[model samples]
Target: MNWPAEAAAGCSCAAAVAASFGAPAFRLLSAGLALLLAVAVIPVCAVAVRAENWRANVYNEGLPSHLVAVDKNRQTFLFFEKKSPLKLKYSFPCVTGQLAGDKQELNDLRTPEGIYFVEYKIASGLDFREYGGIAYTLNYPNPVDRLRGKTGHGIWIHSKGFGLVPTRGCVAIGLKEIDMVGPRLTPGTAVVLAERLDESKVPQPDNGTARELRRLMHAWSNAWAARSRKMFDYYDPDSYSKATESFAAFRQNKERLFKSLAFIKIYNREIHALEGPGYWVTWAEQFYTASNLSTEGVRRLYWQRGQDKKFRIVGMEWTPRDVGMRADFQKGRLVAAALPPPATDASAEAPLPPRLDMPEAPGETAASGIPAVPAAVAQAEKLLAVSNPLVPRRAPAPPPAEINWGGRPGMETDREETPPAAKMPSAPETPPVLPEPAPPATPQAPEAPEESMAPEALSLTPETRAALEQAVQGWNTAFAARSLADMAALYDRERYNRLPGVPRGQSYNSVQRDLERRFRAPWLTLISRAPSLELQGTLAVSRCEQLVVAPDGAEQGVRTLWWQREADGNFRIVGSQFKPEELGLAAHYLEDVSNAVSADLEAWRKAWEGGRLDDYMSFYAPDAVQQGRWGAKNIRRQKESLWARTRPTLVQLSGLRLLMDKRGIRADMNQVYADSTGHSDRGTKTLMLRFDGRNWRIQREDWVAQTPQPVGGSPAAPHQNTQRAMP
Candidate 1:
């Protein structure tokens, strides 16, 4: 009401009443009404004031002011304000993976539960239908995820224009909601992903596990700075081996750096920790400087609490971005140089890097340990004033016709095309960049313990095999004849250096000198039979039974020679391993046997390409299986029938990788097949070969069909093989 106007109107009405009736009677009635009005207004005004205070207090005391939290179980995405006086700025309905559980391997449709950070925002060049014109990628497989041997890449918080459809290990929300929250998710912003989140259950400031993790991180960092071997002690060697590179390889690399650099400086900044389902993630912005290399990046260390109630680092993830470390180092060096020398003879030790001082929990009161309100439910009375609708329940459908040329089938392709001259990212590079995961596989039967490939069935062609035999004989003759030129011509110094297991302090020059000394011995003689040769790509391995005669005595042994093809297209001896027969046992030359199996694989490919049906059939064992047809006879019958109709014109194999396990030698390679009918297809070919006394025969063959596309194409985006467990 307008108080002045109402008062004037009331006075006019009172005057009129007084004039019409008796003055005393009108005055009494007016006073009585005014008293009644005052009595009603007093409590209303008081209630209004109290309600405002309550709203303000609720905001200040309740909620976490700054954080992004995702609850997979509830399908809620919450964003809080960065400023103090706790408030939940945005709450939106979201959808996670259709399946539940933590992601483990590639293509596993389950969101990983962990703490991560927004690495970057993808605003364009994405499928509008799939990504809702914007997406933010989270750094999954973060250092901790990698340490756990978790595989996959490309987990993102995105929006889909069609609907909030459940994702394949991604978090999705509405378009409007994402647009509002996207700006706040800057690079390095903390993101906590959990199966379920409850603000009321937030841990207190002094979380024991988090503190222990921080201590462990400091100890490891200190050891690294000191260049001490104790650094390895912090790592779970067995887990580290499976997660990233082999423990030996990692140690060797670190040791080499430790010996090479005179000093190392590491400063960690903005350290924070977040507890996940079963692990804790501790991350910091790290600045590293060595003799020649300087880099700065965000490093996340994943720790698992053990049975002994101790935390140990299991894996680590690094996000490299320039943080001006080089400039900082130069500036610091200049300042230090300007200072005068110490007066004492002995220089003072440098101060250690600052220890982690975690911030206390926000809004703790004396009377109550918890905040004024649980962040997730601050305004329970008006919770859905602005809320996203639930995602429609529907199965994923393929997008409409689009020119997704290079991307995997049914997925979006990049809008921007690169020039022909630009280099394309290959399959090997996907593991580090593309977020993906794997699935459980059936266990395979173990093979014989002493399974080794025979020399005769090596991958070498007949001509190459014959040449290798002659080369071995010539090497022996050259040694006996004291022909230095002949012996030198057969050796490849560079290739020899690559040969593993070479004795320490021995070099190509030393071996040559030793050979020269033996050449001068008048009674020195070398006799050797034809050598078994295996060729994989340009590298070959040859094993020979040899007898050496000297003035003092005679000796017999097996000589294993490593050969490499030189620029001149000749196979030259790169390295040699010798074991004496006096031990009454054969040399355990497993490496040699593996190489021979690879050679046989190449021969098998050659036979297929040449349409040598009999030879190709012979490569398979008597009980071999191909494409579900059991027994070699059945497999051969199918192949013969197919070949009669359309002969293979080209059968090319590349990227051959062989793994020798207890079951047999598993050979995986990319194969391209073309036939007389002009049909051409490509796929990954996996052949399981078992050594059968004299040859490595294929026991089982499997082919996974793939639509061959130019690398870096959209089609190849989601098609990536699992990264090798060992580096």
Candidate 2:
């Protein structure tokens, strides 16, 4: 109980005194510290857990294993697993064609939507850098597309480095993503490309039509084997008439071959059917053998349900195994064989040696004992017989009658009088009993002309000419004002509008969108001269030289506008064409202006990258206007603030196009900006510059954003200075 006892007793007394006085303050401090720790650790813990169990989460979503789905509208490709707990394996951002919609024809510039399978993978020697690092070919125009008459080829899923640029009817992703996903894919991997794919929705195949088509195909093959006329009956008589005057003619042609050959065999394989909007299509590989002659090819048949509720063949196309065979048949071998029967069987029998005058099939050598027919006879047969016997022959219609208006009877009318007007004029009041004409008067001296004659009749009246000039001036003013409403007011509202680069008639909404996009630039100027006005009654053509200046660049061209006089007596632009001046001093001047503007752009970019705020600002004119998220305003303060806060690390420019005219220059380019903070953005930048004696200075600037969001799908907050960087 001596020293140890005394020490324990003293510590107990000290602890009791401290706890009584400091308990309340200490508890509060402890609680504050605990709250701070929870705030910091909870998010980290949640993230860790999510990272560890993401695959499990995916499985819970019930996605099939090894399936990929592309959402074109969302620009995402999702990979799924098909295990006990279906899960999304991976997801990647992707790009599609420049335009949206299901592809319908070649050069439609749209991505296709459907269930497709990877036909094959292309991993090497794909020197085409634009296609990214790897490619997977898809079987587009698969039986369904062929039946719909949709034509195009070479649609693939590929990469274009690390950018998200639109593709030419192909699916695109980053190079790194392609590298990771391409190797995991194999031939026949199912891929569904749709505008959008809801995770909760299930996909179902329409197999009822496919089954019926299979039965039809079997019957077709059996008919060929039996050389029966039932096969011809499957074809719609009206459709068959397009190729032959009647189904009887078609049967007659087939009958000759059926009887001449000892036996006919058709082997069908790889049959596929797809249901379309109003019809269905079937495609199959058909192996044919007539006596000793044998060949293989693809046959496509279009079918539609008739009033009798049965599918009948409506159209047919054949692609031979050998491409040259099509040329040979088109040149008359098939036509000659289908011609009407000769007067006697002797002439027909001579041509029937069971030998085809066709090129040797693949893998066949000259030593093969296959007989060859004479080429001269084949050519003669083609020249003498029509290729399609169904087409009726008829004489052309007679030329139309010609008669002049208000002229002596039987005078030939001009080309414009094809349509006759209502009602005929009564004979002129019996000539009002005119006095007898005197004998031929002596020829008077040729009278001097009142005015020098013009080479061509002047169709434009003074009033019409003045009105056209005024309209053009109004249009020029509206363009300079950068007012979309004012610009639209000059166009005819009732008719479709057309412009340069737009061949098809454009709707008012489309033209309005175009105008809005154009006016988004801060400044625009258009000047025109030497307008030639041609008036034809209510229609007029105004052609002139035009110079356009905008933020993107300047352009010098010849603009021809079609104007129609409205019922209200005002002229409105109905259509227009802009042809860029390609030769002479204008072209040379544009080249010089482009070079100068480009140099200025490079200088500006260098200054920004170098963090020389003063030098960068120097490129702008005193009155330079900038349109951005803050709206059109003076950019001096914004630039100063940006330079104070951050500095640029990298700058990339691409797709630079220049237009130059007498007014100034405009430069449009894609700009990628990276900052020291590791944040990056890509957008389109348009700079309008005017020549300030010694150099080109920016008079206006506009930016349109095209940046991808962060990986987790949340968009980055708008940067104070960069908000206006995108459209």
Candidate 3:
């Protein structure tokens, strides 16, 4: 309105107001408007606030954020990792490893525990190519875990929506958990897991009445060792009087423990103090046995320091080995005598209990009803078979017969491939012992077909590109701020497709709701850094490590990317790979701060190629399921039922790659494994891999047999194979 004042330089403040009024047309301009427009158009935070019943911030407060359940058995494998600031209830379903065939053990099937991170994220699994709409991968066995010598690797916490069901060892939650819990997980989300749910705590209806003291002991013992779910009715909610009443639960747990028929005698009972009915209960389990051999020793139980801490059983120092059990039969006799006679025969009756079976001699197989093999060495046995290759496979080999090929299917062929020059040939040179052909004459690798490969984009010298590195950091910051559509606009439309903003119905309300769901996962931290970007002329590859922190205040890392370029660029990201572990320079970088790849390459290849897949896969979780290049990228998923499925006759394991720190060891390895599957159609495959702490597994398995390309020019990116819960 005041033209003179607005135009004059003398009235500077008035000119500022005029400039604000003249700002861009589409959107209003002001300090507050900028902040509101930044995160996303959808009001995600508000909706989330309304939905969340509880509030906790794991990062800032450093407490248990939330409980995580990997319910596998009856959908009950509740492995809890607390995420602080959890405002709403989060639940989802998942697929599990294959159920082991025959009589397998607990260590077989791999439902992982400890800590992990969401290392990579996708709008879809490469298995479905662009058809699938969103998934995330977790860094399961990290580098910090070397000391304990754990095995198995390449696990994911992805979407069930990625497909219906089935996964090697990945947890497939509902899309809600994907949107809600995954994104907030920075690379450091602590994942504390139990092998399965603790059966001892589950309450059941009262089966019968208890009268005498001995009956109570048996019931308690059954509850303690077996982790019986039937005893849940006994846990008193009133017992938990405070914010934490774990101590009360511990007391009830003890009573149920002592009630099992297997329970011996309670030599001592000491409760220093009591908060309500619960106090720290420290006790012992009293027996150890061998086939015909018998011995007894004490296994002490350690109580939590206070009533609030989780209950743990551990033996204390100075507690005599004899205290756990008597060295002779006298102690057992005495314990039996001390138990007052049960009130009735029904009270003393014991159910048929489960026990460990001993191995019998080979010829004794018929007597035990189980087959056995001889222990002595036989002349035909091949030794020193394929272990693992610490280096590449292309390295020159020694003579054929000189190397041990193990029980691999094509062992004879592999041995035949060895250089003849190193071998003592039976016949004289018929044609000629010719000198090696010149290097140039040998065909190397196939050239990249133009149809499959993307062209280079963003013409810039390394010097100018350096500036973009800094700019990328800022761009990521904006991306983190919920600029979903804005970030997509920066991508070259020619090469990529952006996920549509969240819809209002079954999906979500807007991009903010979608991003907000992703934001809940701790692994989606600080998305503003410039990941490694490679521009191959017209084809650009931008890669970055996903830094995640666990609920335990520990950090885990993942690898991911965005592939695109300018509007005019013809090259595009038609294909993508879901590689979660930080391999190569990325792994080295983990050690730079602090940890860990696949199972097959490390387990089978290292063992078979070198000979240890049999013993190696033995360590694989019985329901050990593996998905890789065994067949097709997306089609080849293998679930090992037992030693039967893997059929490892004999193999060697070597070149253990382990990571060490003050806490313990995080193991990574390269091994060669070969075995006889009793079939001519079979051949051993090589694998390179890492350890996730539970079993020796195959991580990255690029087969000796090249994965076949689809009829079309390019190879279709594979989707992750999934396994369903058996019970």
lDDT tens digits, residue span 286-353, model 2:
54444423333456666777787778776554422321233343332331111122233432112222
The C-alpha TM-scores of every prediction are 0.41, 0.29, 0.20
Task: Kindly list the per-residue Cα lDDT of model 3 for residues 1-727, writing each as its tens digit.
Answer: 0001111011222223323442123112332342343334344332110010111111212123333445454433232332233332444555543321110112223344433434334432245421134554554332222112344555556655344343445555555545555444422233433334332332222122211222333333444334455333223333222211233323433343334223122222211110101112122334322111112222222122224432322112111122223222222221221232333464233322321122223363544443222222111111111222322121121111100111111111110111111111011111222232222222222223354453233444554345445435434554444455654445343323222111112222343365555545433223112355544333344455443321222222433333443335322332233244422221222222221122332344344333343444443433322322233222222223433355544433322222211122222221233346532111123332223333234333321111122334232233221111110
All models: lDDT? 0.52, 0.50, 0.30
Ranking by TM-score: 1, 2, 3
Q: 1-727, model 1: which lDDT tens digit per residue?
A: 0001111112222323333432223434543543444455664432110000000011121122256878776778977653443346678998776444466666655577767777655554578877897777786766556665677778889998887766777888898887667656655666777666664434333424444455456557777877889778777766655554345545654675577655555666545666654566676667554442334556777677556655666666554443344344333321111112222342122223343211113452224322222232223212111121111111111101101011111122211110001111111111111112132232232221143322221245556666676677667777766778889988876556554433234577888897888667544445454566555434566776665544343456788877765546577876777787521110111222433554566678778888898999989989886655779888778778877777888877643434423344455555667778776665556676666545778877765444223344221232221110100
Worst 10 residues of 3 by lDDT: 47-56
In model 2, how large is the Cα lDDT of residue 560? Answer: 80
Q: Compared to the true structure, candidate 2 yields what TM-score? A: 0.29
After superposition, which runs of candidate 1 have C-alpha atoms over 4 Å from their true positions? 1-66, 81-87, 104-108, 143-152, 201-203, 306-308, 324-329, 333-727
Q: Which candidate number has the best TM-score?
A: 1
Give the C-alpha lDDT of model 3: 0.30
Best by lDDT: 1
**Model 2 misplaced regions, further than 4 Å:** 1-71, 74-94, 104-108, 113-127, 133-154, 173-207, 236-255, 269-272, 276-286, 295-302, 314-727
Q: Cα deviation of 238 in candidate 3 (Å)?
A: 46
lDDT-based ranking:
1, 2, 3
> What TM-score would candidate 1 get against the native?
0.41
Give candidate 1's whole-model lDDT.
Answer: 0.52
